[model samples]
Target: MRRRRTYRLTGGLAAAGLVLLGIPPAAAQEQGGLETQLRFSQRLTQEDGTLSTTTGLGVTLSSRTRTEAFLFSVDSGLEQDFDGSALQQKDPRLILSYSRESLSSALAADFSYRQSDVDALSEDDDISDGVLRLDEGLLKRYSGNLSLQLGRDAPFGGTVDLGYSAKTYSETSDPDLLDEESVNATVALRFDLDPRISAGLRSSFSQTDRDDPGQDTDSASIGGTLDFGVTKTLSTNAYLGYSRVTKSTPGFPEDVQKGLAYTLSFTELRPNGDLSGSLGSDIDEAGRRTTARLDRSLELPSGALRAGVGLSTSEDDDLRPLLSFSYDRGLKRGTFGVKLDQAFSTDSDGEEALNSDFRVTYRQELTPLSSLQAGVVLRDTDFVDDANTDSRKLQLDLVYRHALAEDWNLVGGYSHSISDKSDEDRDHSSKVFIGLEKATRWRF
Candidate 1:
């Protein structure tokens, strides 16, 4: 799977082209809407006894048709220190996204180019999903996904899913965080043996490529699935499969791992919610891994709740616990929510790491034309193989908005961030900002 680096923009372009072609010119000329927004802001930040001010501008344009949508946005800013230093660019971001959907298929494509001084990853961004570096710099990313269903109205049907993602860093010295590409595809064919029973065959393949040979890896699997309706509200599924994983390194021999894979799962539909549980084992470059999990969702008259718990073990014989819980409620004039989750994932180096995340959010209407929102998030990570790399991060945000007139609003916010690393000293920063935003929309 290891190969020399080559930048490929064909896949991204094709995805966009397909979406454009899928939209009929007649439809595009018919019903459509566009929205444009502009923002001007000034911020004051204090960090470690140093003060700075930043001025920023942002613009956004979006359009949507019956079956197609497009978005583009850009944000730029310049900062100056109180010590008479010249203004310097802080961080800038440009983003574009396109999506198209039909009765039997859906397509989504996104591209982002951003510069930052901190880690390029976000709270929801997975290091395992793309090529990412531990350090921060200019980053460009592209991703596209497509899903199709064959014979939508027929009893015998199948599904096909394809996804691709790539990442590249600009002017980076780190070999691990350079150019990277990933692709995955899955296909399934099903036949309805009867009204209560169905069987299917599935195959999947995924690969991640990077400049570093040690990080290049691929996995493939083929499986058979059986679905049975035990009752009107209960169903069960069983999958039996074989999987293989391969990895390459500079000095070590190519590692080819193979193993049997299987999963048994059940789902029960309740009056107000649902319950699901699954047990499975899969092979990876590291070795064979097994997991068991149960999840439940509950719907209340004014709120909702979801929870899950699981346990997993790998070839190393190390056991790890997984958990997730979330609750959200609507108030007369506000909303409140809390969430907590812990799960196992791999870093860019292909080493498994456990991550724990907790968040709380609240929003309230303070006046007829004003609102307030607040949120707090905490994240912790522990490397299974390297304890010295464990780290914790915290973020606090508060924002207030008041309508000034039609399509105009006054916005202010405060943000605080802190990071604690086992191998580095603690770091923290705080910022306060106020901005004016104007938005307009047109329909045709």
Candidate 2:
């Protein structure tokens, strides 16, 4: 029921800005549509043996056209203890998103803003970094992206892309919640000598800034790319480049590294699937890095499967394994999916960590107007710089929905989660909730 006042104001202003941006002269002339939904709910939660109840309201608005779209949603309410005392605002949340794309050219832009609280086993909430925190806090996220291409079908063409993202957290004891921001841009030009062969030049720049001054870093690179068709269904791409990275930490001398970077990759297309493999080496703030991976995707009669495996080695570490796998199957009046991924990744603070995630989900249609959904998620994180900072998390969710009438539905769910860290006691949380939801849509 606690929140950051500053972040709330920022989210409100951002939402207003996006709404204003959604209404341009071009969009005003095109066919547009609007959809709204409202939900009222009551939830009961038990955290570490303490019980509380919440009554909440949720609202969503969506507008869209052929080339542009906008969405805004918010949830807020009041909560109290079993004794009906200590009433406070429910953990409030707000999200705003907008996207636009040019129909004639390869031009697109996307922007999104989110403000939410990090609570144990909360519904409709997710941590951006995917690492569960042992404590609770407020998190705000902002991101924007733009990309465009010139002369996509010409012998000579070019493309440009830009991206930015920032994540900030307040009122939390979690060590991994340090605020961070990143910016990236890339430009490329290509010329086609023949239908099956082309060459291009590319330049890119990226920067990562963190609340920890020691983690701030920037890098830039220039490269040449060649695409060759080996056969009708086979192709190869090669890149040769030079890159430089600089790290500046307070009270310490600046560190700079420059080196040659290169990559070789190939792809083969099959009747119903494809296979690809790549090997690359690069230099960054983390140090010199080399990696190789192979991936394959296949379409089955009633399902699909995709998997990948790789190995990565850095200047200061031995070879480490990486894996990715996902499978989805269609059943009679139902669907099921499984996913698993294990790789070296960076946390919100730009620190290196090993992440392993596994998830399984299932949905079944109980009747024409009723359905059931269930999921299980398991996650593990190990800091590369410290041995005592490992953590594991497990969560289970089950929900059932039944239509009561037109534009009305009944919803009930149960959720449980446990967090186990090497340096802290296990944290457990669970919740049960039932609610009614109504939705309507119209176009102008």
Which of the numbered candidates is closest to the native, going by highest lDDT? 2
lDDT of 1 at 211: 72
Candidate 1 C-alpha lDDT tens digits along 252-357: 7788999889999999999999999999999876578799999999999999999999998987658888888999999999999888877666655667766777
Model 2: worst 10 consecutive residues (lDDT sum): 11-20
Worst 10 residues of 1 by lDDT: 12-21
Where does candidate 1 stray beyond 4 Å? 1-124, 127-138, 170-178
- List the candidate 2 regions with Cα displacement exceeding 4 Å: 1-104, 117-133, 348-350, 386-388
Error of 1 at 183 (Å): 1.3
Model 1 misses residue 411 by how many Å?
2.1
TM-score of each: 0.80, 0.82
Q: How many residue pairs clash per model?
A: 0, 0
lDDT values, one for every candidate? 0.68, 0.70
